[model samples]
Target: MIKEITCISCPNGCEMSVEVVENKIIRVENNKCERGISFANEEIFNPQRMLCSTVKTSDPKNLRLPVRTDKVIPKNKIFEAMKCINNIVINKNIQMGEKIIENLLGLGVSIIASQSLKINSNNV
Candidate 1:
């Protein structure tokens, strides 16, 4: 089967066509750069997309925080990964790069604070 795509890795958005059999890319076409080729190969085999979502916090005033992996996890493990992130409850006065969940779902990914959050000490 042939799969076609418009590459989004750069501004050029090169139109690409790739051949796949049993989910493995055998041929790639129309890409003018290395990034497009890499993206096409990954898109066909071991396809992984990013996940971005909000996580709950222990502080009422700071109810949610944005979290994501620095790299993409396996596609099938996304939900399990999400579960790990969902259960996290960050405390007040958290700072950026603070670990929120460790080895999330055994995916070797961690959810962390992208920004600092401060909460009322008494309520939180």
Candidate 2:
């Protein structure tokens, strides 16, 4: 089977054709760089994506704290990861890049704060 895909691994966005047989990549064409080959292989076989979302916060000034996975995770597990993140509530101040959940879903990826959230005393 021939599949067409646009490469997002670089700025070129090269559109390429990939041939697959028995769930394995047979050939790739029209790719501008080596990264496109890697991208095609992973995208076709085991796709991954970085999860960016928000977690509830107790701070009145910042009701939602931005968070994201420190590394790309299996695409199939994104929903499960989101459910876990949604259940967490930050009860205190946190800094940007601080780890919120370590080894999320045992995928060796950590959920971290994308932005700092500090409780505002005036809001209390």
Candidate 3:
């Protein structure tokens, strides 16, 4: 099976043509770097994607906080992962890189705060 993929490993965005046989990569073409080859192979077998989204926050002034997975998760699990993340409501100010959900969905990936969020004192 010949599959085409756009390499996201670098800015070049090399379009790749990968030949697979029984889940094994036989040939890779149109790749500029070695990383592209690896990216293409993974894309055919176990594709993954970084998750970035906002979670509800307790502070009214800051209704949502941006968060992201520390590592790439399986592409098929993105929706399930988002469901787990959406259940969280941070009650205190959070710092960037703080782990919001550890080992998210048992995928060995952590969902971390994308930016620092301070408390909103104006709320009575």
Ranked by TM-score, the better of candidates 2 and 3 is: 2
Candidates' TM-scores? 0.81, 0.92, 0.90
| Residue-level lDDT tens digits of model 2 in 1-124 | 9999999888899999999999999899999888989999998999899999999988787899999999999999999999999999998889999999999999999999999988876774
Lowest summed lDDT window (length 10), candidate 3: 115-124
lDDT, candidate 1, 5-118, per-residue tens: 888788899999998898677878899988888988766666786667778888887789887676677778888888777777777677877777767677777777777888
- lDDT, model 3: 0.91
| Model 3 agreement with the true structure over 46-99: per-residue lDDT tens digits | 899999999998788889999999999999999999899889998888999999
Clashing pairs in 2: none
Clashes of each: 0, 0, 0
- lDDT score of residue 48 within candidate 1: 81
Q: Which candidate number would show the highest TM-score if scored against the true structure?
A: 2
Stretches off by above 4 angstroms in model 1 are: 22-24
Ranking by TM-score: 2, 3, 1
Kindly give the stretch of ten consecutive residues in candidate 2 with the minimal lDDT sum: 115-124
